[model samples]
Target: MHDSSVFLIEFGAIILGLGLLGRLAGRLRFSPIPLYLLAGLAFGEGGLYPLGTSEEFVAIGAEIGVVLLLLMLGLEYTASDLVSNLKTQYPAGLVDAALNALPGAAMALLLGWGPVAAVVLAGVTWISSSGVIAKVLGDLGRLGNRETPVILSILVLEDLSMAVYLPIITALLAGVGLAAGSLTLAVALGVAGLVLLIAVRYGRHISRFVSSDDSEKLLLVVLGLTLLVAGIAQKLQVSAAVGAFLVGIALSGEVAEGAHHLLAPLRDLFAAVFFVFFGLHTDPSSIPPVLLPALALAFVTTLTKIATGYWAAKRAGISARGRWRAGGTLVARGEFSIVIAGLAVTAGIEPSLGPLATAYVLILVILGPLTARYTEPLARRLTRRPRPEQPLAPPAQATPVDDQDTVGRT
Candidate 1:
């Protein structure tokens, strides 16, 4: 076969394999993320077939995928929702983050990694896979339930916290000499926040321009804006994902229904490319010999997230069942974890550490969806009573119409 044909065949195989695995995962009551990783491994250097792309391309694709993911998240939430859910969600988010970070850092130390490496590793474990959790809930037709909304709200809160934490952690890893850069990052974030406020303030007016009768033109404009903001954020040395997210949040309140319709296809297409690209970069051979330590790190981090999230949910007046569900739902990690881990690697943390981090992420990606699938059942069993339904009132009846007729006749 010609080289071009080989490339096409490999690409097609990947897509088909991922789709098949995803469907099969549903049937088997597991999340497809692990299968995607397995597919990557199978096609990777260690496996039978290899698509020998440079690391740069894969990294670029992964970065774009994560930015788009964050943008979608931002598009789904509003400031009002944040405010309303903050009381319960924020505490839960904080607890989960703290639990994941502290124990994870300790585990990293136990593995004989440096403090900076440990801190970054801990941060990776701190975040939950919000996308996976949301997808699972929606698939199960539980998205409309009260608990589903609460879990989603908490996930959003967690994302917001991560948005702040990532930069700080990045700065720390950049070393003491880069304190000025950290300060600059702080200012840039503040400016981004201001820009978001302005966008929200004028979103109604902006929507008029983008929500024309011309669907094609409107979509083009929205896409253009998304890319433009993403670029500007990148130029500012702030996270492009943050800019994309802010844009989404700005437009979320006014243009949600229309925006969803317009962006759905584009989002899915870009997102699939992103995940595929994410998988394409994995060289299984690079995974460090410290597999035992990596596993230990992943286990501790997962447990911490579960315990702290559950405690916070309970304190927030969630039922015992809801608490259990929240805990399990929040334990899965994803793209952001990988992003932070990658940043650490780029910052010269250590060579072996990056692969270790990747392995941990791979594990969570597998476990997150599976745990989420069964969270509801576990919650029900733990909290056992069916919640009472609201009672209906009896129908009102008229006294005999004949009596009224007789009185009128008299």
Candidate 2:
């Protein structure tokens, strides 16, 4: 068969699988992410068909997906919203990061992986899928409720932390077995910091130009800025997603409504390609032995997130039920985890660990939405009943009706 023919056949199969499996996932009340992974597994190296493309292409597609995802995330918030919600959001964010990372790191070490790998794994698992959580809450009609803002804020902070976390971990992984000078680290940090500043400072200005009456101009400018920042971040050894996210964040406030209008279609189009390519790259043969261990890790990671998030919410004076809901809602890890694992692989990490990482992602992507769905009822069950109302006093007499009666008597 011709290479083109083979490629076309694989591509067609992937599309068919995604459409079929997506519906199946919805019917089963599962998240689409897992379905995408399943589709990938079915059509990948071990499956009935293989596209035989280079991993580089898959990676590129995934990278584009991350950028668009982040861009959409940024479009959801304004700078003001971020500042206002920081108090409630920051604590939960910290707790989420710590709980996931600490245990993950320990598990990796116990599994004979080194500190760097463990740390990277921990960092990766720390992020909850904001997209999944938001959708769940929205479906439950909880968008404007008290917990909504808090959860949203935490997700935003997580996104920011990840932007910084990626480069640091990447550098650490790259510098393994060698001394990384302070100069190199400083340069990386400085470059990232400067880029962030420019994005935020100039974002509003760029937004005004893009939000003008012309749709084509709006799209061109936005795409241009996105690509430019992505390029700069890559050149500086930082993940382009980080740059893309910052640009989105900067434009977030100014372009809140307009950005959405322009980018929504683009986001969906690119995101589809990203997921399709992601599925195309999986090597299913690598999954079996690591499956059980991956499941165990997923269980542990989810439980820890619940516990920590509950405690954090409780500390913030949330009701017991609210705490439970928060915990459950925060359980699912997503894109960030995969990115971290990919970085590990690039750093010459052990091949055995790769399957474990993929399995963990696959499991969470499948279970995250299901877990999120049940959070509300569970929260209600665990919350305390409302206190009884106090009795009211009897009504007081009006000036004995004295004056009116006396005047009317005549």
Candidate 3:
């Protein structure tokens, strides 16, 4: 009874705090993400106070949060959309990887955390926050812009890459031998490929299985299936997030639409818990020591992300303004960055990684919206060249017709 009381008190406080923080963010026209992280820091270890009983529940909720995030993201596009984007926008995806991923890898290695940490950090830096970007686009009314599709295509490619990247990272973190790791990776890939094929070829049948006329029944059925698939994927050395994503992709039509609408509120709630949960694990005091490096990394990656967006938009033949907008829009990294860092933190790969990632994400999430709003104007202001002044044109004369008439008469 005593432990249960404490759990209720703590968990209740967490939910209430998240609600208030979200309201505050809405009022301030800011993303609640950084505030949620700060709240977690305040209530987590090495902060003002710590929860005694709710941590376990928060952790479970956090995992669910990640699954829902990827799942909703997958619902935004169809299986056909994924294949089309992969085929057409692959060059941009490659450029996104090369330009953005290397900075984090270099930072990790430079810090003497070695190769595994390098790989983890590379992912942290590489993927942009699709959630954040989507929200910003909606907020700023950029959904209809010429470069928006280009941006969406690039984001789709990144999410697809994760279907492969997460499994390999899972194998690496497991500390298996080379052959074992290769086998694990092969299994993971095979599973993912098979899921995709199923989604593409038999998606309608899959949707029919989960489809229900009632929202309550549909929610329970879809949620249960997602959790089941995610658990099985984790057991098979695959990414639970990826499994959830594939499940989402397999459903289409009214079922997908209904699932998205019904599940959005739940997704938001759990996702907030997840961000706070990440913060709870990271020690606030540790963040200060790595704050400088995190800022530097954030600065460098902001430019790299911008460069990536610009190149992609230009390739798609976007106008200068649209290209600049695209680059700026991609600057912010949020949930996925934390997800990647969370994996490293859980594996005890580098003690400083959690703090560094926390600080890095906090910096960019705040800066991301501002840049998205201002980048085009800022770029135009900075790179614009003044035109030379021209000589004044001679005043028009009215005597020419009269002169011709006089000469003819003479």
lDDT of 1 by residue, 52-116 (tens): 53334445655666667777777787756665676656767666667777876887787788888
lDDT of each: 0.66, 0.68, 0.90
lDDT of 2 by residue, 314-406 (tens): 776676656666777778776667666766765667565656777887787767766666765765766658877769857866754222211
RMSD of each: 9.3, 8.9, 8.9
Can you write out model 3's per-residue Cα lDDT over 133-178, one digit (the tens) per residue? 9889999878777788988999999998998899888888888789
Model with the higher lDDT, candidate 2 or 3: 3
TM-score of each: 0.80, 0.82, 0.94
Candidates arranged by TM-score, highest first: 3, 2, 1
- Report the poorest 10 consecutive residues by lDDT, candidate 3: 401-410
Name the best candidate (by TM-score): 3
Tell me how candidate 1 scores on lDDT. 0.66
Error of 2 at 105 (Å): 1.1
Residue 384 displacement (Å), model 1: 10
